[model samples]
Target: MKKNIKWLLLVSLSFVACNNDDETVAETPVTAGSANFSKYVALGDSFAAGYSDGALFKKGQDNAYPSVLALQFKQAGGGDFTTPYMEDNLGGFSSGGNQVPQFPRRSYFNGAAPATVSGTSATVLGSHVSGTASYNNMGVPGARSYHLLAPGYGNPSGLVTSPPTANPYFVRFASSNSTSILADALTQQPTFFSLWIGGNDVLGYATSGGDDSSPITPATGVPGVGFDGSYNALVAQLSTGGRKGVVANLPYINTLPFFTTVGYNPATLDATQAGQLNAGYAPYNAGLVNAKNAGFITEAERVRRTINFVAGKNAVVMVDEYLTNLAGAGLPSYRQTTVDDFIVLVSQGVSAKAHLTAGNGTAVPLQDRWVVSKDEVALLKTATDSYNITIEAAATANGLAFVNAKAIMDQLVNGGIRFGNYHMSATYVTGGAFSLDGIHPSARGYALIANKFLEAINAKYGSTLRPVDLGNYQIQYPASL
Candidate 1:
């Protein structure tokens, strides 16, 4: 009986030891925060390129957030990062087709002489050119999230179309057929990544006056992609071994200078012009009034007119037309009078009307038509809400950290953030944050954005990345001004 008891006890001990081994084999140990991000990869659209003042020039590219962020990362013990850069010096539109001149570059302050065009070359720049651990920054301007997976993405000489075919930045670092933006990034097996996409997804529509809804197919809605599928795919690929990363959400373009610069003032109207406007000769003015009373204050106040040529129809309110008409009618004798003089006169209203001198005097009829209205504000808010919903949903499902860029933009417009000791607003020309096109940001503005990203990173990953110094960036002004 004692021998049998000993044998039973030995078998039980053996079974317990085997069970422990099985448990240990099934459960793999994970290293927390081991994904140190020695290799940094940035992916996004025009904002990623540091496009400012309606153009992508060398100056803006050099001061781009990715480059700035790379500098910060290197100082923080991260590996050196690389970017696919353009060779073009003159940073605006370039001529491609026959006889059609490229869009002229204008000063963000005053429309001055057109900027020179720069040429682009087909070449890559970085430490490693043909391997998994290759280029770091692949932030292609004007690229959609879906475009990352397309096969012929890096063709520089392809037929240029909407969202243009040849992105010189992408063409520079493009590898063999086996390598792609998404595939290459994945192969590198990055420990850390930064993605700021979905801006261009709605940007094209907004810039085209909502006239071009071409991007909205059956597959995607207004905000498009809902991006759930792509988000899931990316998470599956990148988070396979629990890799971590940060993602940025879209901001409301309406909050930018592009939409806010053109406003109108009904009280500044002259008696004769007011009569015409009241009679509906200026239908846009009427819309602005309706929009204002309805609570629209900015770009959302502009009515959308199907006809491009007709005035006062469905279109955004433009203060220029009324000012032009007033100047032509009120001061016929003055030669070579400019819009600046008119703006000055209109801004002062009736208080400075007596200071008018025929030729040199700045006084003229006050016409307020360039400002935004209340209805337009509502429209912008609606668009912003829709976009944020899509962005938040994607981030949540994918376990990616998202920055509320729209809220940041609103803060900038509402005078909540101070950059370089200057309060930033959406006002054109005078606003320190935005460039001349009233759409894109200045170098200082991009710095503010970089700080926002850093804040989000800290929140999501418990990182202590330092904020960018806005003072280091330069703010260029037109020499003519």
Candidate 2:
């Protein structure tokens, strides 16, 4: 009886094993569903172009989110997606054999700091790509919304104009000298599209320390003038004939690592140094007090403007134009930075160990261009919110999928979003999300963004598209590449 029972158990176990072997977990086949992706074109600025490590290169373009999406779309009948490929990985095109100072090579982590890659690129300013559809990507870096609608924005001749009316990236693949970004994209008649613009509208202003070099686009104006009107026009034109697409809203540009990585208090000083700095500002503090007494300023304003330093990490002094024009009274709008202020990333080099001795941010107050005051931050927030409203409205009115990029940024800042076992945040290089530039995403970060796009596309279109494994993408590219 024992032998019979043992044989029965062995037979039962073998049968279960055989059943498990025959029943495999099947993957959900990719499908386009109600949406057509046969001819898909992506339209946006730097993010859409995969401008990682502070510059655009071949590898970065290859891993762009649109390219990643196109590969997945191929499973459902999407055709070949063409890109305006850069000539080399060195980036920074030359004009007439002279390297354009504005455009520079890609940056990589050199164990201690972000360094520009060595080598010259063959990409020229007026040189056009050989193919016709190379503009399928249509992502011109440094483009604003209004720039997309302007004629001759890709005209190489305009590259020499004051303030540069043309973009070099667009000039590389534009069909004609007179063609606009919208025109080139519309000529493709893409069945599916993605729009993620308006960041540059305010990004320039924020990065330039709210300076005049790059002004923020106003939210209210006529079509082709204001962000609202220009965005609406873009949607209306793209939605002609009921074409389906996705629209992603702008994230809080001020919160990006370029503004957030550096703290307000990078001015570390010993007790002796702090005392000496305080002594130097004594006359200015006295003048602020006298100005308050003379009705030139309020007591609160006086306190805010008073520059004080202590032993340890003291807030850097910066020029605040918002302060009362005490310049007439021998005061130059000087104030110590607070938590609300952000020292621009470029200020890091200015406040380096060598320069700190020269008092770039201590003895000599940091210029307005090195700091984004609380007032400047408020301006950025207002513009970003206004632009997002127009973007969300366009998406809803056109029945297109919407990506809440602001929320994603919030997630990256608050406690990071996880993909598989890897987690990413906005904590600069260590966060595994933003690249060495501290503005754009790493390769793995872009892969995560591609997954987010897939999620929105599948939910909106009823497609069962699969997300690529996050493990496949690198968190950071090596300097060798």
Candidate 3:
């Protein structure tokens, strides 16, 4: 009886093991939560359009941040994305035997220096650009925050003119001549949107060495006034559809390679050359004291205006408008650029190379437009801070994600960022961050930006989207192009 009971227990255990040996089930991938990517739209400036190598070309657009993001979005149920492609890889356009206004063809580094493809580029005809298809990327090359809200901004009638009331890039595929960029984007009824405006507002002024426009009152005048009003209105409108989006703030312009590459004290002078430069400025330095004593300038202005050059790394002399007009006193307002002063990248060669002058001969300083003074940098900082505040507040209020582009730029400029197999910095062309234009990002840089956007979206919306392998994105076409 005991043997029979033991045999029965062994049989029951063997039967349980056999039942557990069936095929296992595979788990399904995740899906979009509340966010819908059935229709995605991107609203921004040149960066959004993938303007690189100094022009908006087909290759650049194909690698645009939005385009890169759309591919990742596809994995998470995102749908089709389209852009108003330029006529050809050569970029620029011509109609009726005339070149497109304002858009010079793409430039490439031809070993020696930057050069463009000669003659007329292959143009995209009116038929291709026309139709009711909504443009997924409405990133007008030069559009500002206010321009997106301005009515009739895509009017074909104004594309060829000076203070262009309409944007030529928009005119290429605008649904109607009276359509604003925001209006056109709205017509698509996007389920998801990515907006990065307000860069051009202060950028236009900052890049011009503070000569073109004023940064003050930008995005933060009175509640209903100027940049502040326009920016708020644009954000409010974009949020109307309750579609999720991400907004990026501007970087401090002075920190960019455009303003930081040319150092304030780049003059590497020998002992004799240094002596000559100092001797030349002695009379001008003495004139500053005299001007101060005569009440022409204050004591602080005298010290600030003084120009002294030592044997080693000497400051490049510059024409400062702040110095009291000393021409009456038989002097010019010439002083070396201080640490507070920042020179534009375009002034790199022109500032160091001596040129013909009326009195000082080859030693005359570069003009004020070439160097943005300490005071001007202060103005830029104020405007950038104000604009960023508005951008951050709007993102929070609208329940959208905010990408701190300013921090990314700071990291790139200060300590270079490593993204996969590449190292990108804000050090102009070679850095791989900015293109030949020294403003927009290269393809790899845009890929990294798309990754940032993805990270933000995944975190905010509880999605599982993967980032692009930065190594996959090419930096530029062959320099020979």
Tens-place lDDT digits, model 1, residues 1-481: 9999999999999998978965663463322233365777776777887777555655677777777776766644567776544434334443332212332333444354223233332222221234434567766767765656655566655435566555555655677433457776776667777777766655554554433343321223322144434444544565556666777776775566555443222124345543543354344445444544655434332333111222332122232322222232222211112222121211212211232222112123222222222333344456556655755775676666678887788787786577447676666556667776566777877887887776776677665566666877655545232
Output the better candidate (1/3) by TM-score: 3
Top TM-score: which candidate number?
Answer: 2
Error of 3 at 117 (Å): 4.0
**Lowest-sum lDDT 10-residue window in model 1:** 332-341
lDDT of 1: 0.53
- Tens-place lDDT per residue, model 3, 1-481, is 9999999999998886765533121133545666778889999898899988767888889999999989988978899899998877777767776666556677776766556766666663232375546799989888888888777777776855676677777877788877788889999988899998877777766666666444444555532356778877888888886778888888898877677766787766678877887787788788888888899889988887787767777677777766678789887877678889987765323322223223221266767667787878887888889888988998999988889889989999888998546788887667887776667788888998998888788778777677788888776665434
RMSD of each: 16.8, 4.0, 8.6
Candidate 3: C-alpha RMSD after superposition:
8.6
**Which regions of candidate 3 are displaced past 4 Å?**
1-30, 93-102, 123-128, 160-162, 213-217, 221-225, 310-312, 323-331, 347-362
Supply the global lDDT for candidate 2. Answer: 0.86
- The per-model lDDT (C-alpha) reads 0.53, 0.86, 0.76
**What is the total number of backbone clashes in candidate 2?**
0
- Candidate 2 global Cα RMSD: 4.0
Per-residue lDDT over 46-67 for candidate 2, one digit per residue giving the tens place of the 0 to 100 score: 9999999878999999888999
Which rank order by lDDT, best down to worst?
2, 3, 1
